[model samples]
Target: MKDRLASGVSIALLAALVAGTWWAADYAKRAVKEDPPRRLTHEIDSFVEQFVMVRSDEHGMPMTRMEGDRLEHYPDDDSSEVTQFRAVSQRTERPTMTATSQHARMDQDGARVVMRGDVQLRRLAGQGRPELDIRSEEVTLLPDEDVAYTDLPATVVNGTTRIQGRGMRYDNVSRELKVNEQTRVQIVPGSTRPAAPSARQPSKG
Candidate 1:
């Protein structure tokens, strides 16, 4: 009877150990399944710059010239010192965007870029004269659409024209600008004004 009781106790202990091991393994599996996947991060060791010149057949010649500087691209964080950026179209229309403290944070998939800081943008006329100047706090650049926009209040100056708005969108590809919310346009004095209409002729007697 003593030997039998000891054998029974040993079997019970073995069964408990097996059950505990199985429970631990199941818990680990559940934890692994519920945990979120990790995102990959790639750090940039040094600053880099890129300069690109774009040409198109529409002009039957070279169309645009672009230069950028002090760009640091990372997988998840923002780049630093994107100091200079300029684009010149075929008609000699040059548009430039720069920042004193520029940083671009890219999406994890690298589909979009968000630019922040003391952002200033300018558009030049065909004569290389400053036509437009824009200041904003934050801007986003969508490469797929070749567009840039900002939600912060902005001041835009184009030659004799000055405008202020709460938000703005610029189409880099189409060369169009749209301003939103409380837009005001002011034309500088001495700028060319529309000609006045002539008085009607007197009726014949």
Candidate 2:
């Protein structure tokens, strides 16, 4: 009788251990399945110094500039750069132009920049329009690409032209303007009406 009782107790304990082990395994598997993947983060030791940007011009005079720190370039997303950030000093200069602005984010793939908080652009030489003063929540810049657009409407004063548009895209490569909905472009001393290019008939040589 005593042997039978001892055997019964041992069986109960073994069964309990197996049941507990199975429950713990199921819980761990469920936890892993419900969790999301993590993003990649790289720790930057220090910022870059004197990053230069250059573009070829029609006159053979390429635009060149040396931009200082607080400037970060992330190869992943070409959409934003932290310019003139409070953490570091930033500066940009060119032969024909020198401009300064605070808080800039440039995209990696696309030719776009989001300048924030007291943004300014200037031309050192050429016309009397020495500077472009802009105050906006955000300003998009496609400098050489001439393809800048914003989600929110912006007030821009570039040289003699003042433009108020919901969004604007200028293709420097093609020299064309892609105005978004409710766009208002005013060329100083010129009419605001859209011009139709003269149609040409095909000619046989």
Candidate with the greatest TM-score versus the true structure: 1
CA lDDT, candidate 1, residue 104? 52
User: Which stretches in model 1 have alpha-carbon errors above 4 Å?
Assistant: 1-101, 108-111, 127-130, 193-205
Cα lDDT tens digits, model 1, 1-205, are: 9999999999999999999999999998887866468675776656666734354445465544444565555544544334454444433333433322255554533335566677666554444444556678887765444566788897766566666878777765555666766467677789874221111321110
**Per-residue lDDT over 39-106 for candidate 2, one digit per residue giving the tens place of the 0 to 100 score:** 53443334565455555457655543324355565433433355662211121332133334577765
Worst 10 residues of 2 by lDDT: 196-205
Distance from true location, Cα of 12 in model 1, Å: 27
Per-candidate TM equals 0.49, 0.42
Task: Estimate the overall C-alpha local distance difference test score of candidate 1.
Answer: 0.57
Report the Cα lDDT for residue 40, model 2: 38
Clashes of each: 2, 12
- Which run of 10 residues does model 1 get worst, by summed lDDT? 196-205
Whole-model lDDT per candidate? 0.57, 0.47
